[model samples]
Target: MSILIALKQQTDFTSTEQRIGHYILAHLNQLPTVLIKDLAAKTYTSHSAIIRLAQKLGFHGFRDFQRALTTEIVTQEQQAATVDANFPFSASDSVTTISQKMASLTINAIQTAQQQLDTTQLAPAADLLARANRIFIFSQGDSQLRARSFQNKLVKINRFALIAEEYADEAWNAANLTSKDCALIISYAGTTKIHQQFVAYFYEHKVPVIVLTGNPQSPLIDQATYHLLTVQDEYNFAKIGTFASQAAFEYVLDSLFAVMYAQDFHNHLQDLQQKQQLIQNGPLTTK
Candidate 1:
């Protein structure tokens, strides 16, 4: 766990310890190079107070605490440098540099999405999916590509999902959905006019709409029966492509798929293994 989370969970600290904790959490960037005396003086506390606070948090002393803080800062800075949601690569970057950066950015995106995912939402979303008579996914562009991949996975698991490849197809599918069906709409922005129209249509049909989006405050949330938040720090108009958003979406979808499959864990695994064996054996020779 990060120091920030640790500090937030701590409630038994003395006033002096609280001050030290607050300072450390707020000044994580400066914690690495800061001396113990410097931090004590800055927080208006003493060395003993600093060491006590560190021990309270399970560290041996201020030195050990600072080491952990420095390590976390380094990891975060490295991820942030490469995972620029808007601008991942620079003009001066070489081909090798770009490849390394993209790999780092993709890894960071998936990790962040996992860390920030709301576990409480998982069961309910999985329940909706597992119980639905049919599933309809609405998305466009890269997000739609992820939706398609998710649909394919659901098919393999024997839970089929419907997705439209064009505007007309999307409208037709939306119009035909019933209350028994579940709708999962993927929108990074969550405020697109077209998506809003679809949401309104789904509402009219009383379809349970589950949204996967990064924007928590988006209008889509008001209409959605359930919403799964994804990572969005990498999305920007100035960015070259949709790298982080798609990764986050896929991670969430994969998690949801896993949860749904877990409902019948043995059966799902058996089905997959059977399919694999079929492929390995190939078709029988004609007589």
Candidate 2:
């Protein structure tokens, strides 16, 4: 469980400790660098009471608590920016205001994804994709659009991808895949029945499955060979749009493409330049 979630659910604390917790929650952006003395002074509590609050939340002390809190704060900085993922802008805002809010939301979402993903998971995920005989992406709706974008990027490196769910032929595509292939599943909620069936098939067949999802407790998490989690601030089905989720998906997919390209950096670059040259100055009418 995330420390942030635990902190929010705590119900048993002394008055002084409660005050300290409330202050930290209210000023999350500044809590990382805040001194214990200053925090206690602001909360009107003693330093010992603040330490007790941290310990109650399962940290060793104030410093330990602050460290974990900082990791979760990467996404919570939205609070400081006043950008709500569900409703970033009011209806009364001007045209430019909505545009600016979206720009900031995109940056925040990518930053959250970066904090959530680590090299330990990305390196192996890219390696699996690079070595797979074929890559199939499983997604639908907005996530399907992101999958198509990733499919296009992979082609530049000579890695072809198929949309497994395209044209309602998902069952046919699944039946055709073998253990040598890799399945890349993209979903925000990760609870669809069809996706679960896909995961089960891949798991039983010894095929590699790479799951990208925001839900940590998703049913699709257990059997995946590589679980790449990227949580955004978007709600389950009630938001202006999938602004944060799609941006995070693009960043994760781009990161995988970059790492795979670097595996054969010189050769990929040479191939790309050669292709550009032929397309630009070929004997056939280029345009």
Candidate 3:
């Protein structure tokens, strides 16, 4: 679990501890450098109380707690910065400020994804995809589009791929899966109960589950055999909620497709060529 989430799960603690928890959640980026004395002063508590709170959250001491929080903060910020650099923007006063801001936001999100990715986790995930008897992708709402696109890409290489959203009973059908099959669950927040239920079911049945989500500390992450992370700026509480994150998911989907194709270059090329020829010569079109 992430340090921020660990602090949140201890809600039944004392009022001072709860205050510390709220402060840490709100200012995770600033917590690493913050002194225990300053935190206690801000929360109207003693320095020892702050230390106690950290210990209760399973940290060795305030310094250790601060270090973990700082690491997460730095990783997140670095990711955000890397995503921001990829997008093109203009400084001209004539250009619409809204357009520029959106571009910058998307760039930052991609950078965040780049920073949060774990290559070790990715290699195993790719191996699973390469060898799975069947691959099922589960997604809902806006995420379904990406799931379908991924399925299409996998099918091009003649992989037995299915999109869970395409058929309502797909998850139920997938319940019979074994370790030979793999399921990819896609969610931005990773908190959706439906997705969680499917993941839990698959996990109990000894199926391999790969999670692609923005939240690494989510309950679903624990159930996943592999996790792919995407980070997007989502501070705006109103207007087009989850838009940035969905865009980030689209980018990640494209990257995943590229990576999988590259991993099996010869097979992918032969499969694509064969499929293209079959479609061209075997199909009749009115157009």
Candidate 4:
């Protein structure tokens, strides 16, 4: 989970703690220099309570917590900036015009992903998926669909794969995970609480985490054993609507699966074909 979400989940938030939380949330951009005593005084809480709050929020101490929070805030701001730079629309643009612009924006994002592609990251991530004793895939919101798709692709290769939706209780599954297992987390924003919780749990237990996300500087990136960066076009003026970033995620998944299949093409193809045959011929009924 992101620190903000962890704070919401774990902090008791006495009136004073609430004050501190509100202050921090309102001013996350300026957190790096904010001192514990200053925050305590502002919130009318004790320094120790603030320290405890920082720990509860998943930081080793105030400085580290502040650093993470600052990074997250800056990342959000940067995404907003990218969106502004790409999205040049006016109230006058028709749906057709807007759609064309959005397409161009998405194309730009894919080009950026092409430039940022790291062959080094791909091999290790493929290795993790190939060699893991067990693989768990976790994602929420739009990313959940992508996670399920990736899980299905992995199963084609006959690996022991589990989707977070199938294993809904992460706390239980995480207890059984070890260094031999792999955790693949997908997040577009890279700031979901449930995703972060699973990542932190796996990190603590020594399980490898492979993160696929748009923001490389995000806190989620810190927990990842392997990071694959994707780009999203943020140029839509309509904040409520979907944009082109999701296509980037799908492209990344497609590339990874292709690389994995190529690594052991013959055996992988045979295994997938066998699984398909079983599904087609062995099923008893539609029920």
**Which 10 residues in a row give candidate 4 its minimum summed lDDT?**
2-11
Cα misplacement distance, residue 93 of candidate 1 (Å): 1.9
Q: List pairs with backbone clashes in candidate 4.
A: 1-196, 1-197
TM-scores of all predicted structures: 0.71, 0.78, 0.65, 0.59
Candidate 1 overall lDDT versus native: 0.81
Best by TM-score: 2
lDDT of 3 by residue, 1-287 (tens): 34554565564588778887887788766676788788888888888998887787668989987887787778766656543333333456346765666666676666556655666677788888888988888888778887877777776666767786676876575675788899988987789888888888888888999999877557898888988876555642443446567767877777777777889899889877776776777564223
lDDT (0 to 1) per candidate:
0.81, 0.85, 0.74, 0.71
Q: Which stretches of candidate 1 lie over 4 Å from their true place?
A: 1-78, 165-167, 282-287
| Poorest 10 consecutive residues by lDDT, candidate 3 | 82-91
lDDT of 1 by residue, 1-287 (tens): 34555575454788788788888878877888899889889999999988888887668988898887787668767788665767888899999999988888788888767755766677798999989999988888789899988998998788888885455587788877889999998988888887899888888779899999877667897888887876456644768888888988899999999999888999989988888776767563233
TM-score of candidate 3 to 2 decimals = 0.65
Q: After superposition, how far is residue 39 of candidate 2 from its true place, in Å?
A: 16
Clashing pairs in 1: 85-234
Q: Mind giving the per-residue lDDT tens digits that candidate 2 earns over 1-287?
A: 34554455454777776667777778887987999999988988888888888888778999998998887776466443668888889989999999998888888888778766756778899999999999999999999999999999999999999999999999999988899999999999999899999899889999899999988777888999998888777899889889888999999999999999999999999999888888788754369
Candidate 2 lands at a TM-score of: 0.78
Candidate 1: C-alpha RMSD to true structure equals 6.8
